[model samples]
Target: MRKNSFAIGCACFLVFALLRYPQAMLEAGAKSVTLWFQQVLPSLFPFMVACGLLLRMGAAEIVGEWLKPLMRPIFGLPGIAAFPFFLGIFSGYPMGAKITASLYEERKITLSQAEHILSFCNNPGPLFLVGTVGAAFFHAPFWGYIFLFCCFLGAIATGMLFRLFYFSKSVNDFIPYQKTPSPSITECLPQTIADSIDTITQIGGYIILFGVAVEAMKQTGIFHFLGNILSFLPFSEEFLCAMSGGILEMTNGTFLLSTAPDNLSFRLTAACMLVAFGGLSILCQTLGVLRNVPIKKSRYIAAKICNSLCSGMIFFAMAPFVEKYAQKTVPTIAFLAETAFTIPIFYIKSSIFFFACAFLFALYQRR
Candidate 1:
């Protein structure tokens, strides 16, 4: 009852805010749409379609066969768990949750395995890290590489920590695994594209909604007030505001961080923290994907929080080596232009090629 009332009240407030500040809302929505088109769509769509196709084609299960030995020792999970983990690494957020949920629904992975994978599998993909953060925001792909490295280590650490303390000792208890239904490629391709479209559309909606909400807060000076409330912290008001934005929605937060004071370490650390945390928007997306599953929400949230902290610590530990080895200087405009132009093309072409190859492999195996 209380939750319902709070939700209703929040919705009312948002409606009022939208009416009160239509222009701000419009502008924010437009920016979010632009961001989605340029970055999110290009980076996520291909990979999502590919992932879906792979699952339907039974390719991931094939790969899982070989990974069982390694997966058991390190993560205390079945080899199939490797599919979501690596796919999440390559493809990015919510995909991990989606794949895990799909696995659970198919009764391929046990509930325990699903829950264990959920803790650390969902991650920011390399495209976003390298192209969006590295090339566009920081003008240096090097920072993106550093962030990815730290995030990967943090994910590993989180998984290991959970394996050590949280998961039960009896890891061998397995659900009788069922292989995914093998839909023909002709049938699978269209459905995979359709599902990917829906998923990307859902993501865009969240981005726009949160983008407008954040903008509304900023317009109303609520963001500034909130920042001031956190002035007691060691960081600056601008930094606090950026973090606040990030806490609600990661893309906007990182966008703000890019414009913050030119403190490399501070900016990188804050960006990494937000990326790892994945913001409230991402949480909603994750939940949306996993809603039907009986997974424990509290534990999932706790795992993400721990993962965020762990990533920050790992970044700090590796800061010295990264600083020494990686170049942080702003790149030339021509270079940025080159990177920006090529990345979307690369993502699209690569994903298509990857899926085509996988589809052929599956077809050949059937024959």
Candidate 2:
């Protein structure tokens, strides 16, 4: 039943893409597809390989130890669950799901812990936000930090909420954690790279398909129609478009909002909300990962709702300040402020990157 449902969803998405962006599909033929494949693989492959090495080396154990205290208080997750929690937050949605699967397979963490972590663990890093969404798309670095904060806060809130209301008594009936055998760095590196590449290759089709659908939606005036419908509301067209896009592709959706005709305040608000929701693209990826896991969609949806509301409230509160200050401040000053704010979040972001690297390092060192 679940498989059939997923297949139907994919078919619907494909049909929607074809109908809306016939030209985009045509343009995205072999050559374009190949180029995208090439571009994404090189970077993604090595990262995945590193991730494998890290897992093999017990790098997660090391980071989990360091993060245990902080995470315990914040989310009430067990120490070992921290690895997947951080993985989800930093590495992106399904990555966290992947880590949870690994832990489950290894009998490291219980199913209950995995479910709890899933409530808040699946977020992308700040770099993806500032570099891809903010700098590349929005052309405003400060907005990226704001968006990150909103998402972070939302995730934390959801985690706490789950702990309060949905605390599960059933522990994971898995194997006890034992020291994992390690491998050589040279062996680990190649393997990690290979694994990462394989993962990207597995998902690359969905990414491109999504891109095509978005382009089709734009060309077919679906966004315009959405804007028209949203016009009846008090918010600007940009906010509505962003809300729609964020649900589709969080980063791209927010990017569109940044380019909307409305004021910066509205754009900032929408961007934050989109990020908080983890966007639809991330949600789909999350669903893919949780397919084999025993996660409930209701929990995920509740988390998103909480995220949207919290993020919206935060942005609205800051709207006047953003509007007043953003225009008056020089780009240089704003950039400096962004840099200052990014520095701290970057540390939090690095937890995932560092964990990935350290995992590989441990494997190789042991080898």
Model 1 clashing residue pairs (backbone): none
Instruction: State the displacement of the C-alpha of residue 158, model 1, in Å, after optimal TM-score superposition.
Output: 0.6
The number of clashing residue pairs in each candidate reads 0, 13
Highest lDDT, which number?
1
Candidate 2 minimal-lDDT segment of 10 residues: 327-336
| TM-score of every candidate relative to the true structure | 0.86, 0.75
Candidate 1 per-residue lDDT, tens place, 25-60, comes to 888899889878877898788888888888888887
- Per-residue lDDT for 135 in model 1? 69
What is every candidate's alpha-carbon RMSD to the true fold?
A: 6.3, 6.9
The TM-score, computed over Cα atoms with residue i paired to residue i, of candidate 2 is 0.75
Assess candidate 2 and give its lDDT: 0.64
Across residues 1-367, which tens digit of lDDT does each residue of candidate 2 receive? 8869987976786687777666667775453366446545554455555566777788877776655555555566656676776666665545766777666655667667777777777776666666566655665555666666666667777778777754544232323445666777877776566656655655676566666666667666778789898889887776787677678777568667767777767676777777777766567656765666777788777877786777678768865655433322224322113333333444356557855765565455446
